[model samples]
Every structure is written in C-alpha cells, then in structure tokens.
Target: MLSKEEIQRYQRHFPLPDFGVEAQEKLKKSKVLIVGCGGLGNPVSSYLAASGVSCIGLIDSDVVSISNLQRQILYKEQEIGISKVRLTAQKLKELNHHVEIEEYNLNLNSKNALSIIDKFDLVIDCTDNFPTRYLINDACILQNKPFIYGSIYQYEGQVAVFNVNKSANYRDLYPTPPNPESVPDCEIGGVLGTLPGIIGSIQANEAIKVICGIGQPLIEKLFIFDSQSMETRVIKIKNTNARDTITGLIDYEEFCHPNKNKMVKEITVKELHEMIENKEDFQLIDVREPHEVEIATLDGELIPLGDIPQNEDKIAKNKKVVVHCRSGARSGQAIQYLQGKLGLENLYNLKGGILAWADEIDPSMEKY
Candidate 1:
C-alpha cells in the first residue's frame, strides 16, 4: 500500500530477496517507542525513521544542551535549551514525511511507564541511568513487548535484547541495579563522540529486524563492542524466574532499591549563592572523581567518593561542610557515609550539585 514516491524511495530494499515489499510493509506498519532521546536515541530514531517506521514514539524529559551536540545527532547548536523529544520529532518527520512521530516530552516514571510503553510494539532503552533502564525493562516485560537495550560508558558500549516473548531480560543479566555511586557516567567516564553512534546504529538495526521478523534478533544475548579496541563480543543470557514475582507494575523507585535514598540535609543552589554572597564561612567538599572535576567543578576540596574514608581527617571539621557531586546523588551518598557510617554530622548535600551551579549560579561551567 505504499505511495508511488514511497515505492521508488525504498526500491533498494525491494531487491533484497528476504526483505522485499513484505518486509517494507511490515516496517511501515511497526510502531517503535524509543525512550531517552539522548546519545543512543539519536541514531536509533534516525535509522528507524529512515527505515520508514510507521509510528515512532519519542520519550525524553531532557533539553538539548550545548554539550549534547557531540553525540546527540538529532540536535544542533541552534536547538539548545529546546525540548529534546519535540525537536527530535520535527527533525525525524522532516527526514521522512511518511513516518509518524509522536513526542512525549515527559519523564518516564512508574505512573506513566505502562501506559506509554503499551502503545508501541517495541521499546528501545537508550537511557543513561539505571533506574529508567530497569523501569523500561519491567514495563516491556509486563506489556509483552520486545525491547532493544543500548548503553555507552567511556570508550565502550553495550547492546542487548530483553523481554521479548518472555526471553531473558535485564534482570536475568544483572538481577540488580548497581549502587548509583559505584557506577560512572559519561561526565565522569568520557565517551568517544562516535561511540554512541556505533552502538545506537546496531540497536536500530536490531529493532528493524525484530519488527519485520526478518533476520535473527539479538534475543537473550548481550553484544559488547569496544570502540577503543575495535573488538566485539556476544554473551548469551539465560531466562530467569524473576518474572514470576512481577505480576504487575509496582513502584520502580522502590523496585530498584528501597524508598530510602541516602539521607542527607540539602542546600539549594540559591541558598548556596546566598551563603556565598553573605560571605558565609563554610567548606565546600566536591566528592566527584578527578576526571569529573576537570569538566565542570566547584571551588572545593577534590576528595573523591573512594577517598573519603582515607581522607576523612582532611575534610574540614572546623567549618560547616557542604558536600556535592555532578548532581546531588553522590553527595547524598557521601553525606550518608560521613554521617551514618563515619559519624560526621556537619555535612550537607548541595541541592543539585555542580550542574545546578552551572544552570543557576554559573553559566560558564560545562557538563554532560
């Protein structure tokens, strides 16, 4: 049922014996929902849209910052501070007028995960954080949809297929979310600009194959590619009984961990600015890694998370200690460790960490 223009446009696809008009038609009929339109989301959506996916749903609660241009291909410097999903949708539709682009410019939370995911036949997990990735996996499992998972860290990237027809899932592979502090991010762990492009393209390829039921999908297997070494490895994942306990969608926050995040007193960026303006005497403790400090940093002592115990004595005990990281999470963990574990009660977690400082107090700073 393709238009004359569509037929001629995809004539190259028609010549492939296995993927003729039937596969093209299947692709046109497929609805693929891509969550997290960041690094991986860029190429995943671009290729799928170019492949002529019928309906492409984009979910992201992020804005296009100047730093995202290095890897987020869908955005440009001109589009900075704009909504990611909205801009991605416009660009994707412009790429191919026949492709329907649905933009959900909201954060995917426990409340909205099921409803949003169920609308699409497949979901792609391009999220950077662990919480959303787990949420996507669980939602796809509950909704009985296939999911393409891709992640980038430094010079390496990983792609996996999970929750397809009750195949092995993320839980079977990891079974638990790592402690947030233990994991490194692109800000702390830098990625090559081309790294996500490689991984995301692979994810898009897998997504289309799964949609058209053409080539063998990467079901229950993890594909690991290291751009630095130019090596690729595939590991088989076994299905687990984790689904037995998952009858319905429970709170994803509590599912990842408990309702209890590390307990810490926090001070907002405005409040911190006030303290600075008022010339208050407080010691700022930046608990981010050395590399992260190099990117965008606050004026503070650079005692990393791992070095806290050894350098506890170096932490200024005379002044009120304000602990911070890229965001507040690491600082929260640091505060909890200092107070709950190490018995230092005078620490406060900066509300949004250095990123907040960049957005509100200081616009000169750069971060991912």
Candidate 2:
C-alpha cells in the first residue's frame, strides 16, 4: 500500500484510466535490474524510480569520464572519475527516497550474471557491448526472467523486449554475435546527447507496461529510432528455438570476440615518446575522426578508420607504423585490417591510443 506521501507524490499517475491505484501498487512491488548505468541506464532508472518502482538494482563497473557528460544525464562534470553505480544510486535515492537502490559496482561476468539477475523480476540491457548483452540474454533465459534491450549508435537507437512469456530472445534476432571490430561503440561512433533520453524513456515505458499488466509491451518486436530523421520502425522477430540450447552460461567475452587469440601488436605511449625523443624513424597514423583530432592528437597523419583501406599508400611501409585513436580499440582495429587485408607486417597499435599519451607522456594534451 502507498503511504499518504507516496500517493501524493505519484498523483499524476493515479488518473490514467488503465493505470490506476492497482497499477501504481504493482509498480511499487516490482523489482527491476538495470545493467550498464550509462546513457540509456540514466533515463531508464530515473523514470522508473520517479514512477515508483519498489527496488531498482544498478550494475556497472565504469567510472565517470568527461566523454560521458554528452549523453549520461545523471552525472555532473564535478563527478568525473567517480564510480558510476555509486553516484547513480545516490542520485536515484535523491529523486525518489521511497524507492530502494541496490548498487553493484562491478562488471557483470559469467560467474555473477545468474546470481545477480535472479534477484530482480525484470532486467534492462542498457549495456553497450555484445558480451554483456549475450550474457544477460542467457542469464535471463535460464532464470526465466524478461529483459528490455536498448542500444544506441550515432543518431540511431534500438529497443526490444525479449523472453517475456517465452517470446523471442536476442539470439532469435541475432543468432551469433557480430565481429567486434565491425561494431564501434558510442565512444568510437558518437551518439547524439539526447538519443539515449528518447530510447531509454521508451524502454522505461515498456517496463512499466510489463510490470503493471497494462498496454502491450514491446514483446517480440524490435523498435528502431533515428534521431536525425525522427523516424521509427518496428520489426517482428520469430523465435528460432535458440533458448532450448541454453543449458548454462559460457565465456561471453570469448563468445563475442571469436578472434581473441589473434592478438594485435601494441606499443606503449611511453615507448612512442622515447622514439620521438630519439628522433627515430616511425610513422604515427591517427585513425580517429577529424573532429576527434581537433580535440586531442599526437600530430599523427590523419587517416580515419573508414578511410584507412583506401589510404594505405599514405602509411609508411619501410618505417615502423604506429596507428592510434582516442582510445586503443579503433587503432587496433585499423592495425588488424591492415594486417589481414594488406598483410602489412610493420604496423603496431598505440597502446591506449591518444588517451594513454595524454595520461603518460603529455600532461598538457587535451583529452575528450
């Protein structure tokens, strides 16, 4: 039963014909687990808490960075480097003290995914990576719990409801994980600041619908939204009996990253600095976008990742070539492509990319 204060706080919700006192009470009794307390997680948790979900469990191991300020709304500029889950929990409590916030300041892995997910009635996939997404899917399938999946890339976002009443799971839509190199995260491929807000609110709406037993949730349908064009599409998904094969959790990292054994060669920022000091002959290629170069760069020849294939002639073949990006991921991808497609033997990824350079070699360099 809602207290007098609780009733007053959620008075706006009490008026909806379909969502009345009983629905609000249902919300107050529901437990939700949100994985990845970044972008999407920010608005999902915020609206759910504000809507009076009884308990919201937040799980994320990341710390706040300046880059997160663009889309992650719950954090402040002053809170940089603070634990994401910790600050998010504090903020959610402040928003709705009537709601309980459980913080898990650790990465979700195979060992803990089932145990943690078992605690919540429903799970929301706000995670950016594929490994965690697959992990959550399998864990939820095993636990027989439903999950709302949301993802944002550049100006586009996707939201889906999986395993609700034994409906289509993520694997039914994507039988296998895509190549990790092909899928650049929000950090590599930027997202509009407001994109998460749009998608996450929809996810929260679906969650409430699921909890309250009101309107039709996004079951067996994938909702895609493009912020640039303000367009939307819903695709029907057919279950392929993928869940029948799921006996237990496997190493999601290995599952998603099939080429994990083929490691890319790397050179530390400090080593690059030493080579610069010694005036050694080497080619430093920046694979980051042009805008990222304006933010912070090591003055390397600008060759964006997309252009790397055509601009291979520009990269030095005789001298050692070190490719870099904002962080090392993109550059490593560039190196992998060069090595595989062109069979270039002299390429090395700048370990940690320009971020590492800023942290280790140059204190004055701007970091985004």
Candidate 3:
C-alpha cells in the first residue's frame, strides 16, 4: 500500500530482518498522544517522530526555558521563549516531514482530557506531577486505550504500559498516590539530565512494539532504572478490582489528597500576582538554593528551606509569611518548619511554586 517515495523514505527500517516493511507500515498508520512535553515527553516525542509515527499529538501549555535545555533535547537556545507544544511540533516536523505533527497548547486538566485522549490511538504519560499521571491513567482505562507510564525521581525512573485491554492499569500497581507533600519533584529533589531520556525512549519502544505487534510488551511489569548503578529492575503487577472501578478522570487532584480541607493550603499563580501587586506585607520566602537565584529572582527573602532555622530571624512573628520553592512542595515543608517552631498565625503557600509563577506571570524567567 506504500507509494514509491514512501518505500524509499523508510528503506533502512524496511530491510531489517524482524522489523521489515510491515513494521514500518504499521508505524505510518499509528497515532500517539504524548502528555506534558517535558523531560520524559521530549525524548519520547523525538524518537517517535524519527521512527515515523504517522500522527503525533503533543499536549502542553508550557514554554521552553533555559533550564530545560539540560535534558529536553528537542529544543535549543533560540527556541527559549516559545511555547513547548509549538516549538516541539516545529522541530519534529523538520525531523520527519512525512509525519503529521499536531499541537495542543493547553494544560491537560479535567475539562479537556477526555476529548483529547479519545483522538489518539495510544497515550503517553510524560507528565511530572502525580495529579496529571492519575488523570491520564483513569482516562485511558475509561477509554480502553493503551497508556505508557513513566516517572522519575532523583536518579531513578519507572516505566510501564497501563490500561490496555486485558492488561493491568496504573492503579493495579500502586492503588494510591503518596501524600503530595511527602514526595519531592525533580526541581526539589533533582534528577540526572539523562534519566528521562533513557526512560522515555523505552516508553516509545513499547509504543512501537504495540503498533508492529512484535516483541513482548512491558504490560503488567514495572521497569525500574538506577542510572548510577547501571541496573534495571522489573517488578510484576497484577490486575485488581480497584483498576476496574476507575471509570474516568475523576478529581485526581482531590483523589490524591482526600482531606483537601485538612491538607496543605493551596493558591494559584494568579493569586500570587494579585498578592504581589497589592503590596501584601507577608514575609515572602524562597526555598530554592542560592545558585538557582542567579537564573531567576523572586520578590522574597532567600532562606533556602534546608537552612531555615539558621535564618529564623528573617521570619517575623506578627507578619504574614508566604513560602515558595520550585513547585510548592518544599515550600510546604518550609511552612511546617515555620509553623512548628515560630507558630506564625498567618502563613500561606504559593501553590505551584516559582515554576508555576514563571508559567503564569513571566514567561521569560528561567525554570529550574
């Protein structure tokens, strides 16, 4: 069914012993939706495009920042200020003009998630946050689509294929998300630059295998990688009643934290702007390290949550205190420190942290 030019274009892959013309043709007919366009999405998108996935959809509302240059291989310095979905599509187009690259320049919230997932043949969860990951998992299960899951911590990463028909889902492996504040993000905990690159490529591999109907998929098996040790671990998972109960993308944000009222205080990036403009007399504290300050400046004192007690004098008792880190998790810890020790009456958290602030307020600020 391929034209002369189509045959010539995929000539190299077509001649392979196991993956011949059939595999290449399968790739040309498959459509994939990659969520988050970030660390994991960058590598997944790049490899899938290069391998000639016919229709690719990139969903992200983020812009390329200087700090992302470390591992987001799809972007360059010139594309710094551009939206992630736009720039990613542009680059992927250049890589393979034969592939149809689509862009959804919006965050994957509850409102648009179902409509988006229904359009693609498969879904890739490259999102960094727990809320979005659970959302993607639930949505894929409801839609009966295959979902490739990837997650990374300091130097470790996990990958799996979830929500496929007759296969295990994300909830089957880990039924409940950890306490939001209990886990640290890549910004707070830090990740090796090449970590996502390795894991995401594996996710893309699973996608390709699914399309070609070759090789055993990683379904019901969670692959763990420790880059430092150059070791990989595969943990087997089984289907459960809990996964069956997941009908659709429920309030994942609330599901992750059932007692939202009793949990940490939350605020939006817009709220932070309002407080700043109104000249709120709160002790704005930045918990990020001093080196990170060289790239971004916040209108707050730098106490570096790790060294908070050493600089306790900077936090006044009577004044309101607002703490923020890269993405608000550490800021919650800082809040706990201040409240437990200083016992401040008025304390607030800049919910999504400085990264969210940059995304919402100033696109020019570099995100770490």
TM-score of each: 0.91, 0.93, 0.88
lDDT of 2 by residue, 64-133 (tens): 9889998898999999889999999999999999999999999999999989998999999999999999
Q: Sort by lDDT, best first: what order?
A: 2, 1, 3
Deviation in Å, model 1, residue 204 alpha carbon: 0.5
| Lowest summed lDDT window (length 10), candidate 1 | 255-264
Residues 205-320, candidate 1: write the lDDT tens digits: 99988888888888989999989889999999988767666676666666665623455678899998898899999998888888777788777889987788888888777778
Candidate 2: the clashing residue pairs are none
lDDT: the better of candidates 1 and 2: 2
Query: How well does candidate 2 match the true structure in TM-score terms?
Result: 0.93
Write out the backbone clash pairs for model 3: none
Higher-scoring candidate on lDDT, 2 or 3? 2
Which tens-of-lDDT digit does each residue in 30-122 have in candidate 3? Answer: 999999898999889999998889999999998887778888888888888789999889889998888898899998888888998899999
The residue ranges of model 1 lying beyond 4 angstroms of the native Cα positions read: 257-260, 288-298, 302-310, 336-341, 361-368
CA shift at 336, candidate 3, in angstroms? 4.7
lDDT of each: 0.85, 0.91, 0.84
